[model samples]
Target: MRKSFQKIAKKYALLKQGWSPQQNLFYGFLTYIIIGCILLCLPVSQKISAPILDHLFIATSAVSTTGLVTISIFDTYNGFGQFIIMILIQLGGIGYLTFTTFMLLSTTRKMTLWHKKILSTEFTLPNTIKIKDFLKSVILFTLIMEAIGSILFFIAFKNEGMPTLEAVWSSIFHSVSTFCTAGFSLFNNSFMDYVDNNFINFIISMLAICGSLGFIVITDFGLMIKNKSHELSFTSKIVIYGFLILLTFGTAFFYFLEPSIVNLNDSRFLASFFQCMSAMTTVGFNSVNFGVFSQAMMLVCIFLMYIGASPSGTAGGIKITTLTAVFAIMKSRLRGRSNITFLGRRIPYERLYIATSSFIFYSSIIAIGTFLITLTHNFKFEDILFEVASALGTVGISTGITGDLTTFGKLVIIILMFIGRLGVLTFGLAIWSKTITENERKVLKEDIAV
Candidate 1:
């Protein structure tokens, strides 16, 4: 009996010690969602009673930094509840690895090999970049940008005649939200009132752009400045160029396609540019009602959200890097070339594999999510598809269907938002890693036609 007890104890200890980094990331966000849900459920958190599921939905959205909501946040939650949400957004934005690593550094001033392993899994760093530099860059850059954004926002709000205390709180909340690309707004209509307000528009756009650019670009730029001999990495160059091309194209096309822009008159170009920026950055803020957008305009927004922003940042979707790599592969194949190349540079096979995997897995999620939501909701296909793309991209744009979603539809969106925040690739790895085994066997190879 004593031997059996010892055996059981040993098994339990082994189980406790065997969590992989992917597993840690997967379970870490789950814990945050649950805790945030419970806190939002407390009597002090709510201004009025609400369904537990609504609170759970909101909690999941906040922790994922996906701003989809079934209830009005202003009406549902009090100041303390809003504070809880802001904290969750901040945590989700910086990421689980960043938070844990920062805490470790604060307490121990050192990182173990295990911590390094987690960092590697969470971020896709270039060969030239160091993990230490990446972590410091993320934390420091986030602080500085958010600080600057808050001040700008406060000035804009005060100029707009908002009360001083309200402006202060709104500025802080919005600065963090915009920089994080979380898209949570204290305002009920989400900047609709300030649609033509150039100051507010500029501040939000700048914050979102900086947040969505990813830490790689920020770190690379910092290194280049610190060392004159240093140059921007290929990845950074691709991100910047791709960002500009997409932004210019999206704005011009959106301006011509969106009818409401004509109504804005003097603010027509600004409206188009801001909306495109919001979608491309995955920040999800809309100055005008998305419900009024035509199908073509909606498709344009969908494409932007689907591409999302750069990797290793708060923004979701498969990432610009993945999209670029996929295009490079297609270009190479079309040229009858044996090697994949982009911009005269031969692309690595490993990156191609990741890009392909991400594209496939991300598309599969959207299709499945849309179908599942369709099974429960009576909304139009375009509207349903938009919601799925928004949730999966973590962009949070909707065709006014979010609040009316049935419980099942909300649950489907909740799952998509969670997957988006975790990342389609990371989520896949987290699950697949659990099934990996050391034992190897040889297998016969087979070929199939494309």
Candidate 2:
């Protein structure tokens, strides 16, 4: 068995040699989803029979770390099935290349050039950060944070009179789910029962935030603590500040402007902040039913989801950094300034180009996805838009229309979730990008109207 496994591994390694990093990542995630779907289809994995499409959807959702579900996970799947999901969540959260690189580093004590290229493709790290440190930190921090969250979750669940064994399992599952920002809750209502429970609310929120903040910020802080002379990088600063501003603005908007949340008898602020955080972090855990949300509030949530937490994190979307660049470009163009700048720092043209491309491409995906869904499903305009944004953002909190989605709608969302998880830019490159030889490359200068 061991020799056979080694032979298969060798064959797979040979196959990967010719593939680009994007292709590797794209196919790696696809492989995980396929395996997960197959496992979920087994008789032992189901509590009751379900459509193969629903199982495929759940597998995609879990593997992408997007929480949109066409069926009740708790009612449909048994313990073993849930375990498979948790594993998928962890894999998606940490990323496809993380474990592979980590194992290579452990056994060989060095990364192959191909491995470095793949890591760089997966994570856009600053020049100052080393891949070795980043990989180690990603693994170490994920384990540490998830561990702490599990302990607290266990305590909270036990205090609420959950059975010992159940609490233990729930704690582990919720901890991984929240930390990964997968938001695949065992509960039917998704934390609605614990709206007023501060301990649960706080723990879940922090876990998601930590995940969404991106490893750049986390690793920056870690380095800062270890070496006092080290300063936080510009990228880290932008991600941190952008996340804070969105969180504060979203929370206040929900509390003051959303009637249903403002009308809550108590813990109104908590509910507002948690919902906002869920969207911003792309965690998808909701303390409130989005069905009661006004159109205006839904719009606000859509905006939050549109510019998700940060890059190189478990969370997905165009990302805060891209949003910042787009804003800077707008600000500069409005003032007729020749160069774009944000927060007193001039943005490089290369970075600005990538950011602008990402902004345009991301927006296009959402628009196209929404338009496609509209053709098939008879749902509210805002609800359809929200669903598209959520799927594209991989922020799975929805307005209770997921199960009712037509088969076509479900397929659209599944595609969006897959694209979102790989990232709009990554997926686009995988499908349309190609290497251009210098000898064949040509530069054409042209000007176009704005």
Candidate 3:
């Protein structure tokens, strides 16, 4: 009896210690969705009857910050439902751990070392910033930015003859949604009608761009622009440069590509510019129709969406740093350089492996998701590819097929969105963390024919 009790106690201890960072994140997101779904399914949250599956779908999309939806938001949900979604977006945008950490600190003034590890990973903090400081900065940045965005949007909406109270609600809702990079629009066509409105276009684009810049970059803003001479981190440099390049090229290419499908006489450069920002940032606001875009234009959007946004932001995708690292690695190999170098400095081998591994894992899923989705529907290959790319990137710009997908197709997309939001490798690690055993085995490498 004593031996059996000891064995049981040992097993319980091992299980207790088995929870990994990845597992916590995965479970955290799942818990968020479950709660969101239940709340959304309540009678007070909906304007009309909604199926349970739809509720789950919307809840997942909201928490993931992906704008993909099976139904219309304004038509199907009442104000309360919209409010709930915005709350979920806020929770998801800055992240669950961030909010919880702040609350814990406020109420208890303490967090365990284990919590610090999770918060550090969640916010992508470096050793320079403590977890408490990072969480406070994140909250302060979000609130300030959201406030400024709301004021701008309010002015724009009021000028358009929106009622005073309605304008206030719209401004606040959109400000939070856009800045969070959660593209749940109250409008039907998603800023399609406001394509020519410079103020709306300018403000929303800026808000999304800021949100996609990531918390680390935001936290380093002081160092980046200080008149007192401060050094910016390497990660910030890569994100800023990469983000600018994508915006420039995406806008120019989109503008030039317009003549391929439609006459370029009245080309909407502003619309093109907005789409570029929205796609690269993984904020799915569209000032134009997806159906109107030619295959080439769709391809451009797909590429940008696949690249997604910077690390640790509300946006999701392969990430700017990952792609930047992958390209740098490629250039180095082509030049026969001894080390992977970008700009003037050499990147560590560990970073290179991480970038490569991230690329491989994300790319592998593209194929798997595409195949699984195509099997469930008869959609064209290109459309399916675009859908998969958008889903995996967490950019909700659909080719207009989201509403028609079968149950299996929706399941595939839900899985993609979940993984895309948490990221590919992290989700895989979360699953792998189920079993904890240290292995230091070595295996011989062999070359095989390509």
lDDT (Cα atoms) of all candidates against the true structure:
0.89, 0.93, 0.85
Q: For each candidate, C-alpha RMSD in Å?
A: 3.4, 1.5, 4.4
TM-score, candidate 3, is 0.92
**Clashes within 3 Å, all models in order:** 0, 0, 0
- TM-score, structure 2 vs. true: 0.97
Question: Best by TM-score, which number?
Answer: 2
Measured against the true structure, the TM-scores of the candidates, in listed sequence, are: 0.95, 0.97, 0.92
Off by over 4 Å in 3: 1-18, 106-110, 126-130, 223-229, 260-267, 434-450
lDDT of 2 by residue, 277-348 (tens): 999999999998998899999999999999998888989888899999999999999999999999999989
Better of 1 and 2 by lDDT: 2
Q: Write the per-residue lDDT of candidate 3 for residues 4-115, one digit (tens) a residue.
A: 9999999965664567877778888998999998999999988888778888888888888898998888887899999999998888888867877788898999997767
Q: Provide the lDDT at 81 for model 3.
A: 92
The TM-score-based order of candidates, best leading, equals 2, 1, 3
Residue 196 error, candidate 2, Å = 0.4
- Compared with the true structure, what per-residue lDDT tens digits does model 1 show for residues 1-450? 999999999996566348777776788888899999999999999999899989988888887888888888888999999999999999889888696787788788899887788778778898888988889899999999999999999999999999999999889999998999988998888999988999999999999999999999999999988999998998998899999999999999878878978788888988999999999998988899999898999999999999988988878878889999999999889989999999888889999999999999999999999999888878999999999999999888788999898888888888899999888888887787655345544556799999
Candidate 2 clashes between residue pairs 3 or more apart in a chain or in different chains: none
